[model samples]
Target chain A: MEWQNELTRLVKTSYPIVQAPMLGVTTPAMVAAISNAGGLGSLPVGGLSPDQTRSLILQTKALTTKPFAVNLFAHQNSPVNTAQADQMLQFLKKLCAQHQINYPKPDLNSIIFHSYEEQIDILLEENIPVVSFTFGILNKEVIHAFKEKGTVLIGTATYLAEATLLEQNGIDCITAQGMEAGGHRGTFLDSKTLPLIGSFSLIPLVAENCQVPVLAAGGIYNGKTIKAAFTLGAKGVQLGSAFISSNESLAIESYKKSIHDAAETDSVLTKTFSGRWARGIQNKFMMEVENSGLAIPDYPIQNALTTPLRVLAQKQNNKDFTTLWAGQSASKAESKPAGEIFQKLIKETESLP
Target chain B: MEWQNELTRLVKTSYPIVQAPMLGVTTPAMVAAISNAGGLGSLPVGGLSPDQTRSLILQTKALTTKPFAVNLFAHQNSPVNTAQADQMLQFLKKLCAQHQINYPKPDLNSIIFHSYEEQIDILLEENIPVVSFTFGILNKEVIHAFKEKGTVLIGTATYLAEATLLEQNGIDCITAQGMEAGGHRGTFLDSKTLPLIGSFSLIPLVAENCQVPVLAAGGIYNGKTIKAAFTLGAKGVQLGSAFISSNESLAIESYKKSIHDAAETDSVLTKTFSGRWARGIQNKFMMEVENSGLAIPDYPIQNALTTPLRVLAQKQNNKDFTTLWAGQSASKAESKPAGEIFQKLIKETESLP
Candidate 1:
């Protein structure tokens, strides 16, 4: 049925929402819970290998025969110097010593790039109904590949210009991320030039300019904000931080409790965690990163350099070394079952006039 | 002849603008310039006695008989405690020694506040049409006295609750002072609960509930922000900090330059100069205020205490010590004739659709 607002109608869903494919946070079970509840679920395959990405897609389908999207970090790995990577690894080794754990050698597996071409082949064969890319534009070849298979192409942008670029490339929908959203700022088109586009300002701007529908992302957790986004002309709202503590997600219980306790003041943009600006709860790890006068290596290498620290920190409850990625709407993250959260969010959205 | 549907029309100006009645900065000449330019010009008579207030008003009337408002501090009198005032005087006496001049005694003039009630009485007898009060709210008794005389009473509120309270008390209009505004915060309700209401969020919230016309009074200087404020539901826009450099203002050249050179990141809210929080271009005075562990007294007492330091700092060309008050829109403050500034603002406001 061609409805007035087909995003709400075209996607058969209990709610006009997408469970954001938050890499390292979005699990197979998390995708299942949101999809099974009749909303589109997204599995983040951004930081994973081809085998891992294939397993997640297959496992998500295993749990729910319902439609789901596979997300990829389409951003290029920035050039990392061999000498700089060693210094970053050395700093990590000292942190590993704090936990009395043996330092592991940096291997090719850590810096390995999973081709979007290969990931596309898997999704195409697996018949994934949706595919989303973040951090950069999906090239014409890859976008065309997905379109040939009837897959919905959702390209993410952190600014209006990127969204314009996405629409220019025949992308289906655009996601305008405000500064408050946590994790890697999927913005590379001169973050300095973009007006600190708060959701209140950015959504109206993008919606007014773009021909394709814009899905508002960043800081939308409560039903009030969700309704406000829709009122600003968003067809659908994609949520990331709100799903951090869901029962189906893989975060530690303390992480969930931390999000619950955080207020609007708790989040700040710092390059301390992963060398890229992301919003998260101000933690001891963030403090240490600030204090350690080190020129942070590039993203994926920096991502690998801090892996041991994050893993050990999460396991030992030493929050100082943990890579705690959270969005501006961290306070709205729930530890309840995803189904209840979805129902409640939809109910709240409907409640707002 | 009363205009409805917009806060601007209620203001009854050819151009929907108000000349910021800056306390020390604005002179009769500047007020007349804005008035002559088809905008409402204003001067702070709070610093003057009833006789002096009448003289200034008449002086401005000689320049232009058009509508102009007399702004008054709404408190009872200067809150300067004798002991604290003595201590501040002693500190200034030492600086006076360095300057080879005798330290002036607490000017009885500075201590003498023409109470809003007393000021309104003067204005009423003089047949003044508009009166605006800041620093606090004028009493309902006084508000009624002016309203009976067909005078418009404008109250300054730093938060939503204060705005609601102002309207409840029959205030004819309100100045929505956001966190970006310079000068003493209008702590009509409570000092500690002073809200840093940014203009983007504040104007609409106040306008949505306010029956009286809403005037957005914060970091607004240029046409873009003026248009934004109107679009956000303001009737008239007020510019205090932006007027610091006008030909009729009292600021030193360096003081005006400080504002002109400021970036959006340059402003900081500090309780350094006066005890109450005020945003300004951060300087050495701000550094001292940040470092000083002294518990500043309330309102005019703290204002009186710092008067010596500010005055001395300006005379000695020591930019560090002066209480250089400005808002987040300091970058837009320009050195020009008052008429040109008013004309520019009005032209910009009219340019908006």
Candidate 2:
């Protein structure tokens, strides 16, 4: 049951589950141990600068030599204009005055992170095991480049039509995401469609119709859903929320503990956190931000403007100001060390009674 | 491809699509042509007498000796006490008067046309080729009795858990219904937990998980969907809405025309018309029933009480008083001779572009 079909041959994992590479939560060590324990591990690089991405990859490599994946946000790059940035800075300055924090000058918006080209170059330079992209399609040139470099390519899609689009665009595998998954929104594939498919509905539809293997993600924290995904014909499962507090993760300790203390219904999707849509436990700043109805900045700008506040809130152990992004299954998150957590996941898979 | 499925073996037809047995619309001739064309034809028994069920079986056989399925409502008998029936009738009396129909007494509640047990007995006695139960489950004994007599026992479930429930009991096949299907709302598996697994979500999930044969039913009116269903691993597909307006069907011409003018968003699920959950085109009667705060009786009784109004509405071609049960794919419906429709459906599976 553990070693069935092409997925086992590709990943060399015994179970049909992969600990998903969450941008800020999943660590290189976590990915390595999970892969070593018979499941694929992933490291996503959306929140880091290009040099930072290079450093994280180097650091993750030092921790483990096992095969692992790295995820990239393929959304286009653009920064907020100085005028909008200044207005946003003034608004934040007022909030800082109210909160009694010295308003820092906003040079944070200048931080341009790894473009896919830059990231792809680093991945090829380091010979990364697998490369996955989300939030948009990879064009022909990129696909050809990655194929030449012997990368296993995967695409994230929230609907069958989008999964079909990804397949048409030459993705080796498709991640059929549900509405329940946390982190940055993956609605880029079908920004125009009215109906969004949930995980329970999307996985089977994509799996049944697509010729390639489908990886199920979103709200899958345990072995029960792992089994359910396999039963739904998913060749593999990608987990997002289960690795938060693992020893390999770099998120603030307070952030990790908040995940452990979360409730099933605590998570809500709001652009307030990042300007782009994301799911996190409802926090004070988020609630206030949500109701402010101020024309917020788009993806990268919104993410940048909120960074100072999030960092300050984190430094102060203030869950209210921090983003605290979590999947719907956050409450079930465990605080175990990375290696043991993977082993426990496998153990739980074995112990389904 | 027409020869590539269980539906071909069951109905001995070239097309796997079945014209759903709409309670007030389907007729013996419609079922006969579909079965003759090598697709399952369903004769609805929810509105029939026990004698009608027995005679319809013989009538269908006289028209065509081909195999066919009979659909029945299997709600757990909610005992109808005299007082409850009186209260419901008195409540409906004012509404019936508003419709300009004769206010009949409450004899309709006591008149159970066909108990599930008695209907099961009739099918066994007649040795019908197939039987599908909806609205809820029948006892295991009924399933065994039908199967023992060589009847294929199909159960309809709105969610996977209920499908699992049917599988745990003794069902030969299961229908994964989405919110898009028409007729009486058989969503009683659990009031709160309707998975509403639309065809896009349900077909592959059911096909992958259930060991029994899986049938894709709901909102499917085209060959592309039938072909898609087979690709998703469904052994066969059962269509209910496509045949509603076949040349052989008993639906009033006005009803058939109404179906043609429908848009994709035209049909919605409402507890109108029959006082049971059903998906249909919005009508004056439906709007009235919805506006009235009076509670409705469960199946059969509510269905029976409204029978007079519906019949009178049909006689007068009055749209307001009749329940037009239609699935969401009503826009795609084409009125043809049943055999021609079946031929096109089978041809679609055989020849894909």
Candidate 3:
């Protein structure tokens, strides 16, 4: 069975599997390891500054000469609303005080925020081979610029409409992110409600509608799931939770342990963490914040406000405070090197009838 | 390409496809058509009296000699609270008045409420070959009786735990119902939140854990989805929304039209219809009732309160006041005879690699 399809040919990988570029979880070594092991590894630079993004890409390049993708947060930053920010700050302060942790004052003004536009020049300068983005689409000019550089562009979509829009905007590939996906949903289409289409539905719907090759993401952790995605018309599969426990992942030990010990029902979608819906294991913070019934500010604002607490929690090894983002099949994650996991995925998929 | 798996053999069907027993939608003709077309057809008697159940079974048996399953609502009726019921009644009266429809006075005492236990005698007397249930598990005595009669007992499960429990209770097969499934969720385990696991995650997890043959339900519509379910480790596939528009379905013309016009994003999960979560197309009644924020009575009570409105709406061809139960891929539904739909499903599955 030849696995060399349009998606694999476009991405220049031996297999159609792509490691999901999960923010805070994906490391440079992990990206390089997956890329070197015959699958596409993605470096997540969603909230990173241009310098940080450049350094990570350089580190990955040093480890492997294989093609990889650089992912960006294409979401437009919402204007800071002082009243809402103050309310959230007070709420977080109360939560921190109750937990006996010092609440660090967030210097919102001093926070260095780099837009995807600002990082594009750096990506071009570094001669990155592939680029992927979520939360929104890039402008026509930026897409034109990437196309000129001969870089393969992939966009994330939570719905068929979003996938169609990505294709119209000249995206080379579409990653159909299902509701079972762990990180922030890439729902950019304006609708009265959130689209929670699962992979079983979303993959075939998007693949049948869009001419571009579609990669299925969310709840995919093993060879069987990979084959399921392909059977549903996906050109490839993107996996995040499966690699959260890999040796090269940047997730803390407690987070990795939670993924290992979790069940299928353990992960849930909650907006309290980043004000954008993300799937993670339910914890005290998510429960209390949701139960409080307070209006959560939009992302970047909520993300910035909670950064100090998450950083402190990470340092203290407190799983409750930090976001333990994982897909529905977190329990299938294995504690192995990224290359070994990649190799196993290839073997498992090949062994399937 | 032979589809003679354990599930197919157990159900006595040529194809491992089961037409979902959608309450208020499935008809005797539809059941018989599917059964005669080499797939398992199910007669839904979830809320019907023994006389009604017997008539439907006899009607189906008259149309086809092939074996079919009879489905029951095994849910225990909650203690009726008059205060809550009265509140719901007042709310429904107001809604009816607003719609300029006569609100029929519900005879609470005269309501023909029959338990699954009572219906068991009729099933046994009729020598029903297959029995499937949802909402809760039947008692040990009921299982023993069914097993003694050589009945193939199938159970519905939304979570892996429920599937495991069903397997432990001597269930012959388990239907892994994903969150994308329409109608009431069969969540029996007590939990703080609902389990919304998708088919991609739920089917594989349930299939791997349970010893019984697993059937994947939810968001499955065509041959490609059937293959996807099989690849995900399910031995068979159960689909409801796909058959809603068939010629033999009991769904009203307006309801079928709404399903035909729906997009993937058009359907949503709402609890306002029956005080239990069910997916359907978003309509005026669901939105208005949900916006009212009035406390909804438990099932059977709430189901009773909304019955008049739903029935009236059906008569007037008004889609706004009725439950338009459908899965996420409702748009994929085709208008055809049930036999044609069944044959098409088999043809599609066999055509896939």
DockQ of each: 0.07, 0.05, 0.81
Best by TM-score: 3
Please give me the total number of clashing residue pairs in predicted model 2.
Answer: 4
Tell me the spans in candidate 3 whose CA falls farther than 4 Å from its real position. Answer: none
lDDT (Cα, tens digit) per residue for candidate 1, span A84-167: 778767766775677576666567345675656667778888988878888787777888888898888888876567888998
**Candidate 2 lDDT, B1-353, residue by residue in tens:** 43546645654555556667776777889889888876788888864668888988889889988788898878765655556456667766787777667755547536764567777778887878788878788887887777678777788876566778888887878877755577665566553223344454455556656888777776565555665555555677777678877888767777888888865445666665665678777787776666766677666667677776678778877666787778766655678887887887777656754
Show the lowest summed lDDT stretch of 10 residues, model 1 chain A.
A191-200
Ranking of predictions according to TM-score: 3, 1, 2
Across residues A1-353, which tens digit of lDDT does each residue of candidate 3 receive? Answer: 57999999999999899999998889999999999988999999997888888899899899999999999989888888878878888999999999998979797677665789989999999999999999999988899999999999999999888999999989999999988888788898897699899888999999999999999999898889998899899999999998999999888999999988988788988888888988899888899888888889898788888899999998998999999998888888899998999888888988998
* Most accurate candidate by lDDT: 3
Ranking by DockQ: 3, 1, 2
Largest DockQ belongs to which candidate? 3
Tell me the lDDT of model 2 at B74: 86
lDDT of 1 by residue, B127-177 (tens): 777888887777778877888898888889876778988899888899987
For every candidate, the chain B TM-score is 0.89, 0.91, 0.98
